[model samples]
Target: MNKELQKLLRQINDKKNEVKSLVNDGKLDKARAAKEELKALQEKFDLLFDLDEEEHEGIEDKVSRGTAKVIGGEKADKKNLVKSFVNIIKAGFLHVEPDEADVKVYKDALTSDATPNDEGQQGIGVTIPEDIRTDIIELRRSSDNLEQYVNVEGVTTKTGTRNIEVDAESTPFDNVDEAADFPEMDEPVFEPIEYKVKKKGGILKMTAELLEDTAANIMAYINKWIAKKTKATRNAMILKVLNTMTVGKEVVVSNLDSLKDIFNEQLDPAVAATSIVITNQSGFNFLDKLKDSDGNYILQKDPTLQTKGKLLFGEYPIVKLSKKTLKSKQILAEDGTTVTGYKHPVFCGDLKEAITLFDRNVLTIDINDKGSGMWEKDLTGIKVRDRFDVQPVDKGAVIKGEITEVVNG
Candidate 1:
């Protein structure tokens, strides 16, 4: 309740509100900077709150008049000391150059000092900065279609791949003639569905001037760039594998009738509960106009799905891809004179049951401040790398349909 404590508490709350506002406005860099300031304020508020409580508690209340006076003065002195410490931290947040200790912490976080490799050469693990890691995570959440449907396995080693077995075909049942030679048993064959982890990343060169700027949120900027690079590379790899998988003759669609048939016939019936439909935006637009005898749109919204837009085709979730990644072919009517629309490959099935991702490592960063290339330019070179691969398994579980883009006659 003291004036000093009340003022500090108000400041802490105000700073917290400011940080929240920045985040809501999508000013992530500014939010990060404000969060640091708010942390300092909260630390100060905690000290003041505890000190005031202590001054009013048992020890101070039971003391004699003169003793009380001395103790109260001591409490005031302690409050002042705490305030001074807070001011020092605030000042450091403002204009102070990073001290030796701060630089050491930064270096330790970016470099690996563990034992060298087999040749006695030091290998860097390159710890990804938290801000960049966060950006990467958000990107994956929003843009990764493979992980949304694929079976992903994580491994600590630098190299590995996944293997899947092809399900054996069903045999025809025959009447038991009481002694008919046991029909020769068919051996199960294994399909080697393999994937190799690949390394993908980029480097950044920062000038000494930029590094020394006390007001810059360099870490945030670096993290954002790294996140973008990884997102692009990772998405491309996923799309490549999705496009490479073969589409069965029965599932290749040419019209709405055929598309519906794929859903009812080609999609593995067992995994229907978890199945999803995927197509490019153009293809989705075509489907959106489909109607039933009652003239109602067949593509309806389902609030229950986990997809971003919660779109649904029948009961299956629909993932409308704005990406221009899939291959397309034009379609014509049976007359051959009339163009119906384009046929874009539509994928429908449980991705987890049909595809696999081999993750060797997600992201790793290394810094070479003393490299000759940087010395001449007074810059530091930061190198980042990631490893992963994707492959399709159980082709029967991933049905590819040609989503026809019908032209209105």
Candidate 2:
């Protein structure tokens, strides 16, 4: 590389570091300005390089070519990326330089802009590959993750509004005489629900000794930790929205008739057809043991080949969460005394219509070795940030009820 190009590259790197610092301090405006300057420097470097227009050789393209050449004309796999990621993390923690291949992959995976979302800026770090992110998501889904049941919308901005029909099922088309003057119909009402993305994250502190382990082991540990934390955080937010919905009717744990009332009487036929039952472990136990007059279990195995699970009332799919995930609440008893109630909430309805999860689809990690006591303790703080929000849509679509008995205070 020419001296001029090398100088421009150094300038670009310095500008990137500046932008990252500004973003970390929540100075988005300044970070954006610095990013613009970095872009100009990059364009200047590109012009000086004088690459072929047909190839369109950008920095990432050059990095990929170099990586390919260094790896003996072989494509870099997930293992390579994983090792590179671990090396980058170690380099950040130890204040040392990473391997050439590691740096190449890291640069190749770099996002175009440091601050993708204006409202919530990501910290300084390497963005993991898409496959690794997919792995984390898959791990979350392996358990009782509530995201699978609700409607999830990927949003770019931090805040937005969604217009939903007032009553989609009731709004029917009017029939008029052919070629005749059409009668005026009532306008369908739409309610706009605004959603603002919230940042949820935590620091995963690791001992320096763990950095000596194999890259695959380090990757597995990190992926599992992130998946568990993100899943629990999202589940809590989703349940908070679910709790806001008014209960249409109370359900008796031993009474099958009362449980059936939610679907038969409380919910519309259209809604009942697509409704599902979500409850905690205690609630599931009660429903799972319930039998009809003929002594046949109400919850039957799903017969369809496409779906595999036990269906409640031979129709509605049932999802059971752990007690830790779905916590209990304290309620006032009839005697005017406080009681700890294990109100195992059993929610039944079309969850997709009831709630929407606006996912920013951005997960970032920043490593800090100089943070409080890190140098002395030889620990690295890995901060993970996930952006998303949960909001209620049609509150009437879902009905909430308790199955567990309350204890006296």
Candidate 3:
């Protein structure tokens, strides 16, 4: 070994140690200086290592993974396992918890080397965050009548492209004094303003480990949502899914890849059975096992399967359900909550998609009779606001106001 070459090798190792200390101390400036020194030392190393004829391609060593992976098992999978993984992502702990990775690096004055944290030094000046820059092509803008969807990744994937109506137009308000006399009042002339906005995004890329953590977070949130929605829908969807997989009353996994990994089917059925039992012991599927054939639909024994018309208050609907399905009944939703089926099931019928509707009774105002003691029977050509106040409600509607004095023959 040449004496000079050995000295340069030792210098590189010392610089590597200095970079670690600087990074650990959160001294980004000193760390950068140490990194530059290491880069210079690497050039010298290349010359020395290349003294012999190189038989390889342009790049010497190949990276197995594009990015790093955080692995953890039995001993260290504690309550704060996520934190441990993030510690590796950041290459070390920081004084502040930056909301995003790039923000953390920027606040710590990160350079390319400070990013990927490769070679364990401040890293090569790779703009880690600015890797996936994208631009939006705004196809259309919202008008007074309808609006179109934006072509963002999440929107396109989840909602698909569709023309949707939106209340994007803003109404102009005119100053009005209700206390003043009608002659002096300025009837606030109203108009709406319509406009649109476009969005531009910066580049974004993530380490494999970072992406896994993010995916885990999204899964956790979605699972929480599924749990809450399960109750609201009365355990309808997931219960149905679970029941399809269950044999008799017990949950039997006919096929599960993760389960196969843990215990082979050839090993023992008891282990798999026990695992399924414990997994489903959450009481979440209690309603699922209860079937309509046993007569427990809607939690009422001998429950009426046929839909019935609402008999609001003491007055009952004049129609009755026949063996034949009701048709041509218009579904209406006013209060926008509790929906009921009218002549037909307003919620479900020949409709392509599942939906709910509410019935809002139409109001007709009659003219006041002589002396205003009674109202005229005629109700025609009356403006909605003139004859009566039409108040829309979920279960029932309300109509209360002064009748028009003029009656139409």
TM-score of each: 0.56, 0.76, 0.15
lDDT string, candidate 3, 246-329, tens digits: 223221222123223333432233322322111111111221233344554212222232543222111211122121222222
Question: Which 10-residue window in model 2 sums to the lowest lDDT?
Answer: 115-124
lDDT of 1 by residue, 94-127 (tens): 3343222222223223211111112321223233
Better of 2 and 3 by lDDT: 2
How far out, in Å, is residue 56 in model 1?
Answer: 43
Candidate 3, position 324, lDDT: 26
For all predictions, the C-alpha RMSD in Å is: 16.8, 7.7, 30.9
What do the candidate models score in CA lDDT, each in turn? 0.57, 0.75, 0.27
Error of 1 at 137 (Å): 1.9
TM-score rank, highest first? Answer: 2, 1, 3
* Model 1 quality (TM-score): 0.56
lDDT per residue for candidate 2 within 1-409, as digits (tens), equals: 3335435655775577678657866799998999999899988876765553433344346567764334432446788878877887777675554454565565455443232222332223555656678889989984378998899997656687888989867877778888988888788899999999898999898887888899999989999999999999999998888876654454554479878888998877877899999888888888888999999999998787356578988889888888888875556667767576766788899989889999877777777766788779888889888889999998878888777665764
User: Candidate 1 regions off by >4 Å?
Assistant: 1-125, 129-135, 143-145, 161-163, 168-189, 203-216, 247-250, 305-308, 325-342, 366-382, 404-409
